[model samples]
Target: MDTITTLIERNDDFVENRFPSGLKLVPTLKTLIIGCVDPRVDAAHILGVQLGDAAIIRNVGGRVTPAAIEELVMLRKVTQAGGGDMGAGWDLIVLHHTQCGITRLGAEPALLATYFGVDQQELAGKAINDPHEAVTVDVAALKASSSLAGGFLVSGMVYDVETGRTEVVVAPSLLREETTVG
Candidate 1:
């Protein structure tokens, strides 16, 4: 069978045998995970979270660029539309991993700079070579973003591919004050 057909079969199985009916629009776990696009590192599988448990956003290197910040803004809008505010009682997890492919792109400063929406000289601050440092940077960025102004506990994590383990680099804590009411 083709990949799409096989995926359809999996969907059939999910609907018939494992679907959670009446799942709410908001994540039950009250968490949002941002992670890399690498197939080896899946936050859902690593965290053993079922569907509707958490909202996940994946992008290249999982770095918090201008685009990622905008995505968070959109998610806040989505939560508002659903009658739930993303600000309160939410955890934003910046998940990175070891031996990331993003490190390979460091030589292509132009591409990296373009992807991050920053000048080539500013690429040094991104810490693409180290997952730990990258997580720290991302957590700080999320915490300081007024676009996401409001209540959220932000944290950072690093997953080890060799051992299939995840380490919390930054523990969850309220990142900002509630600036606007829901």
Candidate 2:
């Protein structure tokens, strides 16, 4: 009858209809894509990327953590030994969508810190008090710690769901702007 009820009913039907393919996912995905866990944002499908091409690491707001760092290192090793490189030939896309629920945490420092398992008041004292900045900074840190080759590049961007626009926040050389004035 209401919006919430309607949404719940629709989701129930959707899952029930799709249960035949329940978690029957492919293993050994190559690329490592750090993306938000937003239902509206399907990193693989939205990017026109295929399965077995990437290992999607999703979390609240798509924030990169120590685990993400470790995953990248492991992936880098595997790719290298197999005569591949995670940084160069492969892809690493950080999909942070605009109007994200994570941004709400930004305005609430204490709650954000609590959610992230960090000292609330203490972290707020740092220059990076904003939750968005906190997440993006950590993502960048993980990218730097990766053992991917010289060609490997790391970037950050926010996807606009309404307009289907993606804006680069932290641009690695790989996704640099190539301006060709017509």
Candidate 3:
């Protein structure tokens, strides 16, 4: 009848019918995705990934904050401690969507604070005026983190809610500027 009750009932069918036993901690695709909390932008559905394929981190704006980086580092540590192949390529995808709620909060600091329960100053870096630029900034932040090794691939993409299309804003190879031509 209620939301939780519905989910619990559904989960019963899931566990009984299709839930796999003893899945590995390592992602099958060896990737992690950071995306917005918008319901319209379902990362797994849009990306065509099933469960156990990747680790997903969702936030208000999909911004790569310090806390997100910490979680990533922990993931890496856990994977290594489990004797998983760390040298295998790990892709970090930062996915943002068009018409996100974060953009609406840019003009209303009071509303943003009320929603997130923080002061205005704390929300300074959380604004998303442009999804393209925001994705680039977030990807750069994740790539620059020392915890994430150089072998880790980081990319930025924007999912169009209107058209159900995803555009690559920043490729993993282009995360940094190329200063010279070979």
Candidate 4:
């Protein structure tokens, strides 16, 4: 049959034979991964993340845009609604990959500006053309978000499409850490 039909058949088999039952609304690992929308860089497949392991958010460039931050806020509210807190020791990961379509959009300044909701002049600060740099930029953005609260571990990773390997661009740390400069 067609691709959709085949997928539907697979789903039927999944629901009937192999679906895990009684998974909680909260992820088992209490982790959320923000990654590029590229199918080849799917965190679930590449990272061997099984069902309910971690929640995944995919978008262009996997940048920490305002919309993505809002999603995190909403997710926290959602977990609260489900009688679970999304704060404290939860893990947040930003994933970017090589050969992303967003790289191509960098050549189109107007489009890139529109996508980032920033002026074309400010696009250089976004590091749109580099996955490693974008990951660093995105993770820092998350760490700096006041709306996200604190006590969450956040990291950045870059996936290499050619070698199917991932490198940690930023080591995990508290999303909001208190620093006292002496």
Candidate 5:
């Protein structure tokens, strides 16, 4: 009845009855979603993505760090090399949520630095004053990456943890100025 044991039992049930057999490596939706590690913000549920629908990358604050870029590049390369119907291209969705824990770290610089193994100065780059602004910044970083090939659409979104709703902070077209998500 411990947590791990319960989780293992659930996994057994999943594999027995719910697991999708013979699914390919390529996601059915041909998309990638980068989101926060916050338990309240489940990217799959928020985006309505079923299993094998999209590749999800979760991290603290969901910042587009160097490691995230590397993973994205690898995903692109591998999927293209796989040579299938889903190999055409994939879109990117950067989802940040309101009331993220990173927004609170300003009051605990020491803890942040220790957790990330970096000095206080380095922690400034990870700050999240506003979820909307953070999503915009992360989307821009992903779009600017030369490693990610052209023709991929990137959208920035903010999920409201309180209301259980999500809104577009930056549309994929990137044609209009910022709009308040209401």
Candidate 6:
């Protein structure tokens, strides 16, 4: 009846073909991937995670949202139920890509304002919504809001579509050594 249903039905064969063995499924996701809709970047493949191991939130530009944080909060609760829980605090990865249509769209202020229903002047004053900055900012906000143990690890990265390489963008900090050298 809906586009999702239609698409799933049409592709059911493809999905069934992939899961022919009918493996058991479990929810062990302790990580969250916020990535763009670029077809070249597959979050699951890049993160080397199985189907039931991670919760991925993908948007036009992989921007964080209220909904994303809500999902994290719920997941954290589930993972904290017992010792050796697999779903506790989440590792957040904000993956952006080079030569991204979303980035291009982000660079254009007028277009950004037009889509967000605000004017350039308002946007410049932080009154208007910016889709690009919103994504990065949201990830940070989510990290701050999450109350999970170990204080929710958050990192932002840029993926080069051509080379299939990803690099982290770490801000200046006094503590915690950088994990990935960009």
Question: Candidate 3 deviates by what RMSD?
Answer: 5.5
Poorly placed runs, candidate 6 (over 4 Å): 1-17, 20-26, 71-88, 106-138, 146-150, 171-182
Winning model by TM-score: 1
What's the number of clashes in each of the models? Answer: 1, 2, 0, 0, 0, 0
- Winning candidate number (lDDT): 1
Q: Candidate 4 local accuracy as lDDT?
A: 0.86
Deviation from native of the Cα of residue 81 in model 5, angstroms:
3.7
On residues 1-182, what C-alpha lDDT tens digit does candidate 3 reach at each position?
Answer: 99999999999999999897877888889888999889998799999988889889898878787777777767877887776643237778999999988887777888776654558887655446788888887887766666565556678999999999999999876333322211
Give lDDT tens digits, candidate 1, residues 71-159. Answer: 88888889789988787788889999999999999779999999888899998899999999999989998887778857889999999
TM-score of 5: 0.82
Quantify all predictions' global Cα lDDT against the true fold: 0.90, 0.61, 0.78, 0.86, 0.77, 0.57
- The root-mean-square deviation over C-alpha atoms between each candidate and the true structure, in angstroms, is 1.3, 8.8, 5.5, 3.5, 6.5, 7.5
Model 3 bad stretches (over 4 Å): 85-88, 108-127, 174-182
Candidate 3 residue 93 C-alpha distance from true site, Å: 0.6
Candidate 2 structure quality by residue, lDDT tens digits, 77-164: 6655766545544456676776677755557887666655568766553224243454467555554543434444566677778987
What does the lDDT come to for candidate 6?
0.57
Which tens-of-lDDT digit does each residue in 1-182 have in candidate 4? 79999999999999999899998888989999998888898999999998988889899888899889888888887887888777676899999999998888757999888777789999998998888988998888887778886778899999999999999989998877633211
Clashing pairs in 5: none
- Local accuracy of candidate 6 as per-residue lDDT tens digits, 48-147: 7777676677766665545555655565555445333322254666776666665455468886565434576654532124433444554555545534
